[model samples]
Target chain A: MIWLPLVGLAIGFQIYWLPGLSLPSSVAAYLSLATLAGLDSIFGGIRAGIEGKFHDDIFFSGFVVNTLLAAALAYLGDQIGVDLFLAAVVALGGRIFLNLSLIRRYLLTETRLRWRREG
Target chain B: MSTIASPPSRGKGWVFQVTALCIVLGMLLALSLRTQRRAVSEGIPNRWPALRAEFINLKQQNASLQKDLAEYKERYEELLRKQATGQAATLGLESVLQEAKMLAGQIAVHGPGIIVTLHDSPKRDVNETRPEVIENYIVHDYDIRAVVNELFAAGAEAISVNGQRLIATSSIRCVGPVILVNSVQVAAPYVIKAIGKPDVLQKALELPGGAADGLFLLDMIEVKQQPDITVPAYSGSMRFYWAKPLPQPKEKSR
Candidate 1:
C-alpha cells in the first residue's frame, strides 16, 4: 500500500516526459518550490496516519493550498526584490525532515512492539 | 475538530490523496530538471570564460593591425615627398640643359636685331692703276671680322654669317679668293645677321669712328634694322681630344 504513491510518482513523471516538453527558468523555480511543498504535505500526512490522526479533507486541502501558497509567496518575493523563495525552502524543508523522523520512530516502535508480541 | 470515525477508512483515504499529490510533485521535478539541463547545454555558463579571452585577443590583434596601417601610410607619404622634390630637380636640370644648348649654338634662335651687308665698291677710278687702291675696293676678311667683333661688343645675343652660325670656336679668314667662316667657304655679298636690340646694333655699326666706318664711306656696307631675325644652329660637330673636364668641387658647409 505504501508503494502505491511511489508507483503514482513514476506514472506522473512518464506522463510529462513527452518529447519537446520544457518550462522556462522563471516558472521552473516556482515549480520546484511547489514540489517541495507537496513533498512536505505528503510526509505530514504519513505522520498523521501513523498517529491515527489522518483526515482525508485536511490532507487533500493541505496538498493543494501549500503548493499554490509556496509558489505564490516566492513570486511575490521576487516582485518585491526579497528572497522569500529561500525562506519557503527552509521552512518546508525543516517540516519535511521533522515529519520523516517522526514517521521513522513510529514505524520502528510499531515493529518493536509487534516483535515482542510475537515472541 | 471532526475526526473520521473509522481509523481504517481514514488511513485508506489519506494514502489515496498522498499518492495523487506525489504524482504532481513528480511532474514538477521532471520539468525543472529538463529546464536546468537545457540552460547548461546552451553554453552561457559553460563557455563564458573561453569566449571572453578570445574576445580580448581579437581586440589586441585589431589594435596592432591599425598601428601597422598607420606606419605604412606615413612611409607612403614620405616616398611621395621625395618623389616630388626629385621631379623638381629634374625640371631644373632640363631648363639648364636647354640654356647650355642655346649658348653652344646647338639650337636655332630668332630675335629682333639688324642685318649688315657688305659688298665690293661698285664705283672705281678708271685711270687709277695702283694694286693697293684696287684691293681697297674689294671687301676683305678683316672687314667681316671687325664687324663681328663690333656686334659682340654691342651685346649681340647670337650671330650668323650667310646662314653659318658662329659659336665660340668660329674663325673668319681669307682662303685664297673666298672667305671661310667656321671653316665653311662663303662668298660675298656677305650678309651678317645679329640678334640683339635692333637700335643698339645699328647704332654701333653707324658710329662715326666705328669698325664699319671705312666700309660706309666706300659704299661697301649697308645696314638695316629688322623687327625679327633668325640665326641657324651650328652644323659642325666639336670634339675634345686633349682638354678633359675638371671635377666639380664639393660645396663647403656654412
Candidate 2:
C-alpha cells in the first residue's frame, strides 16, 4: 500500500526537475509516469514471486489505483482551475498518505508481531 | 523437509527473503526510470503540470523547426517532381533566405501586422461552447484562413498565427470556433504577423471584399500594420509524429 505514496513522491521529484510546456509534452509526461508505474509493478511482481504466490498480481492492484488517480486528476483539474502540476501533487500527496497507512497496517504490524514472537 | 533444518538456516532464509525484496525494489526503480526517459524522447510528456509546461514550450519550438523542415522538404520534393526544375544540392534554410534577399522586389515592405481582439459577446460563454462544434463566440477557422490567404495574395511572404510563425506545413484547424495554429490553441484578439509589401497587403485587407466583410458578424474586430517589424525565431521542438496521419492507399502484395 505504501508503494502508492512512494510513487507519488517520485513523481514529485520529477515535476521539480523536468516540467513540460506543450500538448505533446503532456503526453511525454504521462509516458514518464507510466514508466515509473511500470517499475513499481515490476518491483511488486518480484516481491510476489518471492512470496511463493501469484507474484505479478500486485501490479494489478497498482494499475487500478494509478488509473483512478490519473482519471481523478483529469476531472479535478477541470473542476478547479488547478493545472496538471498542482493536481499531480494532490494525487501524489494522497498516495503518500495511503502508503503510510499501508506501511502501518501491514509492514509495521508484521514487525510488531515478529517482536512478540521473539520475546 | 524442515525436520532436519538448523536454526541458523532458518535465520538465513529470512535474510534471503529481505534481500530478494530489496533487489525487486531496485529492479522496479530502474524500470520506472527507463519508462520516463523513453516517454520524453518519444514526445509523450504526460506527467504532471510543471514538466507539462516545459514540454509545451519544447513542442512549440519543435513546431517552428518542423515548419522550416517542411519548407526544405517541399523544395526538395519540387525539384524531384520537376524534370525541367534544375537541382540544387542544398536547398536549405540559409540558401533559401539568401536567394530571397537577392530577388527581393523593389515594392517589398516591412511592418507589424494588426492584432484583432474579438471578445466573446458579453452574454456568450466560451467555456460553454462545445469545442467539437462551431459557435458564435469563438473565432472560426475560415476567418483566419481568409485573413492569411488575403495577406499572402497581397504579397505577404512571412506570416505567423499568434506568435507562432506559419511555415509551409503549418496547419490551422477549427475546434468549434476556436482555431488551433500549429496545434497550439489560441484565442482572440488574434495577433497575425506578416512580412511583405506592407502597403499592398494592408490595402488588400482593407479592400472592398476582404476581412472587413466578416467583422460585422464578430463581436469585436481590429486590423492595422505598423513599421516596428520583427519576426521572432521558433523556440519549440519539431518532433516527428508517426501516427495521426491520414490513411495512405496500400499496394496489393502479390
Per-model TM-score, in order, reads: 0.54, 0.31
Best by lDDT: 1
lDDT of 1 by residue, B71-140 (tens): 9999999999999999998998899899999999999999999999999997768788998899999999
**Superposed Cα RMSD, model 2:** 38.8
- lDDT on C-alpha atoms for all candidate structures: 0.85, 0.55
- Model 1 bad stretches (over 4 Å): A1-119, B1-68, B125-130, B251-254
Tens-digit lDDT string for candidate 1 (A11-114): 77777766546776436667778888988988998888777788777777888899999989988887676878899999999999999999899889989999
Write out the backbone clash pairs for model 1. Answer: none
Model 2 lDDT tens row, B1-254? 22222222221233333333334344434444555565667665444555557778898999999999999999988877773433333455557687564333212334555433444445455457575443555567777787788787877766777777666567788876477987888887677877766667767776766664555455445556666565444445555687477787995951
Candidate 1: TM-score, chain B only? 0.73
Superposed on all Cα atoms, the candidates' RMSDs to the truth, in angstroms, are: 14.2, 38.8
Candidate 2 regions exceeding 4 Å error are A1-119, B1-134, B216-219, B236-254
Best by DockQ: 1
